[model samples]
Target chain A: MKVRSHRAGKLLKGLWLALVLAFLYIPIIVMIALSFNASVSRAAWTGFTLDWYVKLFKSKQIMAALNVTITVAVIATVVSTVLGTLGAIGMHAMSTGMANLLINVSYLPMTTPDIVTGVSLMLMFIFVKVPLGKWTMIMAHIAFDTPYVLFSVMPKLRQMNPNLYEAALDLGCHPAKALYKVIIPEIMPGIVTGALLAFTMSLDDFVISYFTSNTDQNLAMIVYSAARRGVEPTMYALSTLMFIVVLGLLLIVNRRNGLEDIA
Target chain B: MKRSWYAAPYGVWMVLFTVVPLLFVLYYAFTDQSGAFTVNNFVKIASPMYGLVLWDSLRLAFFCTLLCLLIGYPTAYFLASRDFSNAQTLVVLILVPMWMNFLLRTYAMMTLFENNGVINTLLESLGLERIQMIGTEGAVLVGMVYNFLPFMVLPVYTVLKKMDYSVIEAAEDLGASPIRVVSRVVLPMSIPGVVSGITMVFMPAVTTFAISRMLSSGMIYLVGDMIEDYFIAMNNRNVGSTISLVMLVLIILSIGLLRKVDPDNTGGGLW
Candidate 1:
């Protein structure tokens, strides 16, 4: 009787998990399916067609936003990866008190509300008379993205052997060369993870970009505006494409290192 | 070490951007139209209209956090108790939806709950009453739970997965019933994950403007939406800054309370 009840409990648990999974994926699947429907109404499905996908490509505004988003993500990723990797190394070498202070400084941005970060940065830009545009957006992205990168790289730094850099110096390498050749290769995994994370964040951001951006619109900002006016069919197509791309990237990353370790 | 000097560039950048910008918000929050120091902006929050909005925001966020915990804890436990390979696959499945754009995900919920949308149409075809689901408080709550559920699941799952199975087995050997084992062994040890999940879910839910705006068509006025409207629609920086400061204080207080509950701070990261 006990064994039978155990089996029943296991079955019930399995059913509950399936229900949760269905809840998570069902709405997303419906949206993706509606993207291909010929009619604009989300309630009724017309015949399937690739017309929305074709229109998505042809829309000049979406194309512009996509271009700006990619550019900003790439620039922010590169800049934050370099700065954050260096900052991690520097913090690793500092005294405990100094390192703790800097770490707290880094944590402030991550914990702050997005709206606060958005408005405060907007206020500062206006105060300094820096025109809000693509550049301001990129600057804000770097500011937020760098902290995440630092957090990522710091764990890897803590795990490294402290004598590795000194050994390289003893082997007749210059300090800069030793950093580039020895220490960097050791922490390359963290740097790569940090870069990818920063890229994804910059691409997905809307709130901060909404306030900091002027005439230049990123993909998220465009989507937000469209959602406000009732989302266009072309947005469904764009989101479907983005979903596939991100899923592919994540799968590739997961294969190399366990997904749990990334965070 | 000399390498410590490498942080100089980032230090300067943080001071200029991070420190200065927050200080600017503080200045704006406390000053008047002509830049004279004043408490009027802070006093505005005590007004009935603004106070109600703040209360509603906290109430809704608390409910969303509670719901996420209720749903996520069981889901996490089931996954963690599974065989290793199966558990890993399920974790990936949970994470897949999270990679999609946040705005798009909320928009999908909007499409589902619209008056003439898929759900209502289905209800009508089944000879059921089609209730107004969109532009309702319930819709906003649903949106928050949907968007932030994964954040709750991941942290709790990580904690549960790391828990030693021997401890559970020991409880079973002690003649404890299944319920007793769970309550005495699993629940106590999982408090850190629960605390982390609460903060992760509650923080975003309270500060979210996009989900509330999309779900309720601006009918819901959470603190976040109010702040966004003040800055963007009304173009009132002073009032917006004041509201933002109030939000910051509330968030800090909640985190402090949660920290007291989570003394050891075991589940600190998203992973």
Candidate 2:
């Protein structure tokens, strides 16, 4: 009786996992299936066709939004990576009290709700008479993304040997040279991870990007406006393609670093 | 000492972008249209109309967090269990959907829940009447659970994965039933993860503008949607900033609670 009960318990756990997986994936799978439906109406599938994919690529609005999204994400990632890495290094060299203060201050952006961040940034831009546009959007992305980079790099800095930099300096290396040759390489994994994380966050961000941009619509804003109006087959197609890219990138990152570090 | 100065540019940037902008929120929250300081914005939020919205947001977020915890606790347990041969692969599966664009995933839920959408169509073909799924509170709750479930699962899984299995073995060897082993031993050890998971799921679920907007077809209004409309649609930054300030306080309080529970910064640091 005890052995049977244990087996039943195992079966129940397996069933729960399956049920949850179904709950998570069914909506996504249904959406992906509808992207190939010949009719735009989600209810009726007259036949399967690739026309949505063709139209997705042909749509000027979507293409333009894609261009803007990539541009903003890349720029934000680059700027935040440089600034955050420097900041992390600088904080590492600080007194413990100073470093803790800086770290807590940095948590402000990460901890605050995205809408609050978005609205505050929007108000600030108007207060300073700066127009809401791609640049403001990029700036907001950098504000949120920098802390993540700083966090990712800080862990690596903690793990590095303190003697390595001193040894490089004692061997007659310039301070900057030691930083470049020894310190940077020691933290390269963290830097790369941080940059990738920044890019992903910038790409996926909608709320902050929505408030901070006026004329420039990224892919998320485009999808928001389009989804609000109604469902479009071409939008589904675009999402599938984007989903594929995200899945591939995550798989690569997972294989490389186990993905536990980032999450 | 020289190296510490390297953060000078970053410090300046943070002050300009992070510190100054938040001060702008505080300023706008207290001021009226003429930019003079006033408490009327807070007075406006105190009225029943906005008060109900706040109450509804709290209710929805609470349930969303509860449902996530219920669904996520077992999911995390199974994923973290040594009995599962492919736990790593399952973990990756959970994360892949999470990495997808936030809006796109919410939008995808609409396809399933629309009146003429997939579920209703299947029901119709079976000679059943179509049920109204969109523009309802339930739809919004489902959207919240769907989007934020991963947040709950990941943190709990992280804690459980690092948990020592020998304790469970010792409990079993000492004649403790499976129920007692989990209830007494497993549950106690997983509190930090559960707390972290609750924070992760609750915060985003509370402040989500997009999920409510897309899933409810604009019928439901959460705090996030309220802020968006005040600032964007109504052109009332004062009221919006006031609401945002309230949200910031809620966020700070929760983080404080989480820190008290998990002081060592485990469960992956809340971001």
Candidate 3:
């Protein structure tokens, strides 16, 4: 009787999990299906066509937003990755007191509310008389992105054998050469992970970008405005494309981490 | 050159961007339109109208966190208890939706919750009345639960997965019933995860503007929306800064409470 009850409980749990997963995916599936519907109205399905996808390419505003989004994401990722990796390495060699202080400072950005960050940064620009545009957006992205990169790289730095650097120095390698050859190779995985994370964060950002952006728009900003005005089918097409790219990138990352079995 | 010198650039960057920007917010929050220091900005939120907005935001955020916990705890518990070889795959499936653009995900919800959207269409076809759900408080709650559920689930699942099975077995051997074993052993063991999940979900849910804007269709207003209105719509930096500062204090207090709950910090990182 006990064994039978256990089996029954297990079956019920399985069903519950299935229901939850369905709830999560249903909206996404609906959106994708509606993107291909010939009708513009979300409620109607007047046969299927790829007209929205075709029209997506011709939309100049959307194209411009996408261009800016990709550009900002790339530049922010590169800049944050470099600064964060070096910062992690430098902190690794610091006295405990100094390192703790710096680490605490890094945590401030990540821990603060996004709205607070946005408002504060907006005020800072106003006070400094800095034009709120592409460069300011990039600067804000870097400010938030660096802490994540630092945390990622810090773990790898902790795991590395300190003697490896000393041994390289003893082997007559210059300090710069030793760092490039020894430390960089050892922390490459963390750096790559950090860069990918930074890119995704920048791509998906809306609040800070909303405040900091002057007249320029990113994909998220465009999507927000469009959504407010009743989303177009072309917006659906853009979402589908972004979803595919992100999914592919995540799969690759998982495979590299030996997590492909989960895929 | 000292190796510590490498940190100088980041140190300078943090001071400039993080420290100074926050100081500017504080400066703005305390001053009036004429640049004279005044307490009016802070005093304004004490009005009944503004007080209700703050209270409503907290109430909604609290309910959202509670709902996520109610749904996520059971789902996490079941997944962790299962001995199936493919359990990790299931967890990954949960995470995949989060990788999608959050705005798009919320937008997808908007499409479904529209007056004549998918759910209503299905209801009409079934000869049932089309209930008005969009622009309601319930709609905003659904959006919050859906968007933040994964944050709750992942941490709880991680904690449960790491729990030692031996303790559970020991409780069973001591004549504890299944329910007792879960309550006395498994649940306590997963407290850290639960705390982490609460902090993660509650922080974002309380501060979200986009989710509320899309789901509630501008009919409902939260503190976040009020802040946005002050800064963007009204161009009133002083009032916006005051509210932002207040929210910051609340968030920091919550984090401090979370640290107290999970003093050992076993469930620290979400990655």
Interface RMSD of each: 1.4, 1.2, 1.9
On the 0 to 100 scale, the lDDT of residue A167 in model 3 is 100
**lDDT tens digits, residue span B1-271, model 2:** 4999877777778778888999999999999999999999998899999889988898999999999999999899988887678878778777667787878888889998998899899999999999999999999999899999999999898888889999999999999987899999999899889988898888898898888988887789889999999999999999899999988897788779878987876664345
CAPRI band for model 1? medium
lDDT of 1 by residue, A120-158 (tens): 999999888999989999999999899877877888888
Model 2: chain B TM-score vs. truth? 0.96
Clashing pairs in model 3, backbone N/Cα/C closer than 3 A: none
The segments of candidate 3 whose C-alpha lies over 4 angstroms from its true place after superposition are A258-263, B268-271
**Models ranked on lDDT:** 2, 3, 1
* Better candidate by lDDT, 2 or 3: 2
lDDT of 3 by residue, A1-263 (tens): 98999889988988988988997999999999998999988877999999999898888998999898998999999999999999998999999999999999998887788888888999999888999988889999999988878887898889999999999999999998999999999999888877877887888788889988887889889888998898688888888888887887777667756542212
> TM-scores, in order shown?
0.97, 0.97, 0.97
Looking at candidate 2 chain A, the ten consecutive residues that score lowest on lDDT are A247-256
Instruction: Score chain A of each prediction against the true chain A by TM-score and list the results.
Output: 0.95, 0.97, 0.95
Chain B TM (all candidates): 0.96, 0.96, 0.96
The C-alpha stretches of model 1 lying farther than 4 A from their native spots are: B83-85
